[model samples]
Target: MTAHRAKGLQWRLVVVAGVQEGLWPDLRRRGSLLEPDRIGRDGLAEPLTPGAMLAEERRLFYVAATRAADRLVVTAVKTAAEDGDQPSRFLTELGVEPRDVAARPRRPLSVSALVAELRATTVDPAATPALREAAAERLAALAALRDDDGVPLVPAAHPHRWWGLYEPTRGEVPLRDRDRPVALSGSALHQLATTCSLQWFLGREVRAEPPATAAQGFGNVVHVLADEVASGGTPADLSVLLERLDSVWDSLAFDAPWKSRQERENARAALERFLRWHVMERDLGRETAATEHDFDVTLEAGGHRVRVRGSMDRVERGPDGRAYVVDFKTGRNKPTAAEVERHPQLAVYQIAVREGALDGVEGFTGRPEPGGAELVQLRIGAPKREGGDELPAVQRQPALSSYDGDGEWVGELLADAAGRVLDERFTPSPGRHCDTCSFRGACSARPEGRHVVE
Candidate 1:
């Protein structure tokens, strides 16, 4: 039976076992824990300490055991031996005495009964490779450890260490002891908040029925568009798509008409900008001119040779032996030049580009060519006018365009951000923005609410 089906059902006989550490209620990876701002809105204060989590597991066991209608049989294997046995803590708490079930005599079974239990289960061949590889690796690691007095000393396992594999662009160099771990940036956090707020807002209207128009179903439309772009599909028939989307959007009921209109427009504008940016970047990758997108840039930084495989959105060759690597930003909120300067991701990209880690796209080989990088903000919507009768309003100019060419400046920013992430120095910067944040209620910075601890 599926876990969902078991959620609310209580059986006449209930059995709960496996309440060991790292088994029940599973331990979360350090990096998997959300930031205070993200957790705040969810009404969670602080993350659950390991001790609290263990206690919660025990409590869950108690709850499960007490839910039985008549008989309860809780069991646990204390040791891997003929005489080894132990009672679960919850069973002890319930005053149920431990009994040796393994010592019971075995009864002879009929051939049909044995045959019925031996039925074969189908296995997918494609799944074997990964499973075999995982088994081999685990066995090898186990073999490397020495047992102390017959007790296996499993090597210290850091689940979050796998996070490094996800960041291929970071190269193979180990981070220095002084370097901080990376956490979700402000922009990333804001994006999550915005998505949560939009979902909550849309849920209220769409509860009665499905969205009837694309404009009304703005969130769904944007999601579809993002999926299309991520899959490298052409977004050519936007008009037809928008029409269908508007139909879905119009079906939803909203608290305020003007607010709904603004939100719908905003969602549409963001989707359009993202699609355009993705298309432009894809096109650059296929360009034949010196502006080609595919490149391999490599650099030596912090005692590691970092190699980046990607195409720049735009490349402009200058007369002074300088090449400009341009990246497009379709986000609505524009930060000041000073704010841009402090942005870690942009800084890292600039360093990567300058060090030739991204030079392969431009057909360059050997050492990476030193060049500048520009963060260009592409305006997605038209500027507001006092009064205008134009068929389509003129689009507003991009708010800010920032540039950073200094490698040291970029590295410093990354280092600082990385340090904060490692140190777990998360602080909530709440304001009107908190309204959009999913973790707003769980935030420590929220003056009026209790913090959530998970």
Candidate 2:
């Protein structure tokens, strides 16, 4: 619709403006791509002279005019560059007569067109009596916001402010390609933010991580076990499941053997319960979609691109044919539904499903969108050691704590946060979690009021 971009593309009514003298067939007398002296057999496959560039320009305008299927309107204003303008000399060459705008009498202003013009503008110009009235009406409408808040809540800074045209903010940093790529999971983004400076340092400076705790190590083991069993339709009996567990356990890197053993026993009890729950759910009609699904997606935010990866524990296809992403937690202090709604890991899986990343995945023939997600709680079932006999301290159960939300919104939020994490300016935000975080040692080096660790 802009100029001759619609060339060879027909429209019912095509309007061409600046069909005036100096604009179209914008003859740049100086620098054209075609250089005759530089052209030779070895230069390029096909080369043209300066004259040809102008010739092509004429042909483009011709093509622009002929694109009208029904009617063609070629117009030219009375001015160009603040100097008086004239119709193109080519219009006369084409035997088209010109009409003078100054000669025509003014017609009645259109109410509908005036309303349309006002609707399209953020700030209305009082072009005429009608438009002035329209502008007044627009002001009145804006004064009363749709929400209870009188003013619309819009961010003063672009979420991806690093990409703004201007230079960096007074003390802010800009995003740049680093010594290493920015790789983060949705889970990392879901954590509490202490400072912008600290996050930036962790991403760029400290890329490698230390070993996980026994609690974390056990969760990883269970995830691997769940993925393996769910992928295979092997019998969910105690012996087979325990053997698989033993194999998985042997391959793990635990914080301590004693702690690992304690977790392994708890895991074994939970696995049996999960198997029963898994089979029963299937019998009730939920089918497996994908397990241990790995995704690495590149997102473009505020012009910067970053790669995010996450492994989905399970994605189930319901009888309704919609999918649900599930992540397993085997440790204590499992998050609730509200917490899962804020989990970046699930949001990532949701984005992947919708973006065709999981198209060829199991049970997603046409790429069905994820309906929702849940944290598959498989807490440890350890018994209290009291007196001679041991008693179960907690019930053995596996439940789906559903996160009620819109996938697209959560995905967008993560994308913006990823952009910020990748952007320059790693502001440190030290908080209570720093006491246990390995980076707490580094936080102490920061300015006061933001010291991160114990």
Candidate 3:
């Protein structure tokens, strides 16, 4: 069976009846068997290797086991001829215990007993009311169908032709070619499904907003700084920086030049503050704490792990076993605390840390610290006003307060938030905040404005 068949199906107990040497991690399998070759003079004559076939089987087994909702049981029976039979090498590798069931007698099954068992387990408690209603309507429609043999059928079709039956035909074709086959990579199908689901959930078409010219200009400045830092250059010069600010303002395409100037100045100030947090104060720290060789930090709430391969600005470890998650702000203006709280990306990170999903990060410092960490915001901008201190006006502030001391409370909050996520209960809180949201135009709850989409 294909992995797609397992979608949306869950079981409390799963039994993998067979796991043998040639079945589990089929080590004899090679990769070439699955590769498609163009038709040649000899049609359908592509060579297949034993290794490739075995590898494919192994992958199928992996897919099958991952589909188990909770508990998984793998069984392998041994026969007398193979009395000293070693369990599947893959099972040995995975450290699974294989029980010899041949010594026990098999149980018999009756038709009524089997029917009762199916009835007991077929009901789904987790199905939503809407889903139940839709299923009932579908069943009713199916029940209305009559077969040529005068026998009721459940609309069954060959598994290979299922897609064609479900999808609309592009054109009329004879029965022989009715099931026009189309190839789709697993990854491609997954991405397509994800995109379709997102569009359905949003109830509208979705497209990424092109970055503003102003934002792009500032991004160039950041690109230059990043290059210099990579080359071991110190952050002391302001010439390229000033030019960067000027470029950003010039590219604003704003109706009012003064308004652009104000926005550029505000953004520059934020960037400067951010630079201080990274360079001057060195408040951010980076260390590889886990075998994952990524950013993991231990906290009082639990352990927080973050993958910072390309997107990290600066990572700092605090004395109290807290991690200061910092991301650079090149965009104009800063989001408010309420906006941050509503953002799922940040909320998920908080939840991940609280759940101890990051093993290396949890209690790494061997101290109790807040599970809810702080988010530091640094605004980069021009040097402080001439008469005032050189420090930028928009200094760093913790976007999230510490929840380290109250792990239990944080856990409760995360549990509630997780439930909301599972139930898809997100609601947009639009206001002035929409001015900066990339999704503003398409969001249903976005404030009415000239920029809003109908």
| TM-score for each candidate, following the candidate numbering | 0.34, 0.49, 0.34
Q: How does model 1 fare in lDDT?
A: 0.46
* Residue 173 lDDT in candidate 3: 34
Alpha-carbon lDDT of model 3? 0.44
Best by TM-score: 2
Tell me how candidate 2 scores on lDDT. 0.59
Best by lDDT: 2
Ranking by lDDT: 2, 1, 3
Where is model 3 more than 4 Å wrong at Cα? 1-205, 208-213, 216-236, 240-272, 275-280, 283-312, 319-322, 330-428, 435-454
Tens-digit lDDT track of model 3 for 270-329: 545544544643433433122211323322212321221112333345555664433344
> For model 2, how does the per-residue alpha-carbon lDDT over 208-298 read when each residue is reduced to its tens digit?
3456666676777667667777888556576887886787576666657887787777887777657766776598688887888787776
> How high is the CA lDDT of each candidate model?
0.46, 0.59, 0.44
Better of 2 and 3 by TM-score: 2
Q: lDDT (0-100) at residue 275 of candidate 2?
A: 72
In each prediction, how many residue pairs overlap at the backbone (N, C-alpha, C within less than 3 A)? 49, 11, 23
* C-alpha lDDT of residue 50 in model 1: 82
What TM-score does prediction 3 earn?
A: 0.34
